[model samples]
Target: MALRACGFIIFRRLPPENIEFLLLQTSYGEHHWTPPKGHVDPGEDDLTTALRETQEEAGLGLEQLSVVDGFLQTLRYEVRGRSKDVLYWLAELRDPHTTVTLSPEHTAFRWAGLDQACALVQYSDIQETLREAHHFVLKRNE
Candidate 1:
């Protein structure tokens, strides 16, 4: 069985209709960058895990985010020889100017446009997920 994790693909819209996605750099390991995420706790549902992880890791809670409808992506990969599955759901910050507070697990964070975000994230699956989420938001707003 694969280890499961969940998080939000958080985005904010700035002036001139620029949409930026949030990415955080881990303090440990290879210092990889990714959206806020963590392992699913026993007996907790996926959405609950995503919400909890977002709040714990990014300081953004359910009240600050407007979860997007019909948008979720699951990425399966190997971590330290163990299969891992990460589920990411699209969400928009209720206020674009809201600040993000990071916990000790992450060393830094950035809000970047799709291209920059893709470049910052080392994993190919994450890059693709970001691209897809970007397009999904664009299409939904049209």
Candidate 2:
């Protein structure tokens, strides 16, 4: 059985400088850094799962985000020898100043620029995901 998860590639604009992505360090597993994501709960659609997990993990709600259209990423990997698929949608925080309240599931959170985010994420899949999301926003703005 494939495990399904959903999350947001959440970004914030810092005005005249750069954009930053949000990453959370998970308390479990290898303590990997990832955008807020969790297993899709029963009866929840993918988008709903994304929103719920974001709120649950990062304390960000739908009201605080502006969903960016046309950007989605699917990543597949093995966890405990079982295949797992994670889907991520892109979003922008309405206010860059908004504070993040992390759940116990995560040990820390950071809002970092592209290079910093990639370095912190460490995983090739997650690094590429952040790169793609950064380009997605830049393309949209162009």
Question: Each prediction's Cα RMSD?
Answer: 0.6, 0.8
For residues 50-128, could you state the per-residue lDDT of candidate 1 as single tens digits? 9999999999998899999999999999988999999999999999999999999999999999999999997899999
Candidate 1: which pairs clash?
none
TM-score per candidate, chains pooled:
0.98, 0.97
User: Model 2 residue 63 lDDT?
Assistant: 91
Error at 89, model 1, angstroms: 0.4
lDDT score, residue 115, model 1?
A: 94
Model 2 compared with the native: what TM-score? 0.97
> Which 10 consecutive residues of model 2 have the lowest summed lDDT?
133-142
Give lDDT per model, in order: 0.97, 0.94
Off by over 4 Å in 1: none
Please, what are the lDDT tens digits per residue for candidate 2 over residues 106-129? 999999999999999898999999
